[model samples]
Target: MTDPSPTNFAAPWEAQVFALVVSLREAGLFTWSEWADRLGRQIRPADGPERTADYGAWLTTLEAILAERGVAGPESVAARTEAFLRAAEATPHGQPIRLENDPLYRP
Candidate 1:
């Protein structure tokens, strides 16, 4: 699902989500400490040491924060997420995904 470059990331989407978090904070939507608290609460891995990227959870939390702050509706985020997944699912393996429009998960 990924052909990564030289980076310590489990998946490409993790970097995208991380970048979105930083951008949101830069846009004054939330503070870094608040993100720490929220993300800490969100991370409850079943296996304590089986570490891997959890971009799905990260994106879910991000959407929740956006909803809490009125930056975007939860339904909107869900719709976009579903569409993104649908696009990815339809794409052949090892090919680039193509979304119908600009993603809602970006700033």
Candidate 2:
């Protein structure tokens, strides 16, 4: 599914999920179905609990996968995470204001 955010990147949490999937698959840590099942179970109703899906857990899983694959490290994951955060912060608040285009409408 496509995210509606202005940026063409996944949200921070979504990125983590994607990374997890990739890391696991590359290392043969878990089958796609197994990973999906585990992640689905992690998500819960927002107001349900103080502790929910932990991003750290996902990172740890990724690290384990990398280790299993004998890969160098998570340099790429860190870079992607920084980029996603920058994009999120750069997004503007509320609707874009066009004074000449909407002269009749006043904020």
> Among these predicted structures, which one has the highest TM-score?
1
Residue 8 of model 1: what lDDT?
54
- For model 2, which pairs clash? none
Tens-digit per-residue lDDT, 13-66, candidate 2: 667666657765777767877665554544543666533445654555555556
Report, for every candidate in turn, its global Cα lDDT versus the true structure: 0.75, 0.56
- What C-alpha lDDT does candidate 2 achieve relative to the native structure? 0.56
Tell me the tens digit of each residue's lDDT in model 1 across 1-107. Answer: 37565665578878899899889899988888888777766675556643322677678779889898888997887777687887787777898877743343343
Instruction: Please give the range of 10 consecutive residues that has the lowest summed lDDT in model 1.
Output: 44-53
Q: Distance (Å) between predicted and true CA of 6, model 1?
A: 5.6
Runs off by more than 4 Å, candidate 2: 1-55, 67-72, 94-107
Note the residue pairs that clash in candidate 1. Answer: none
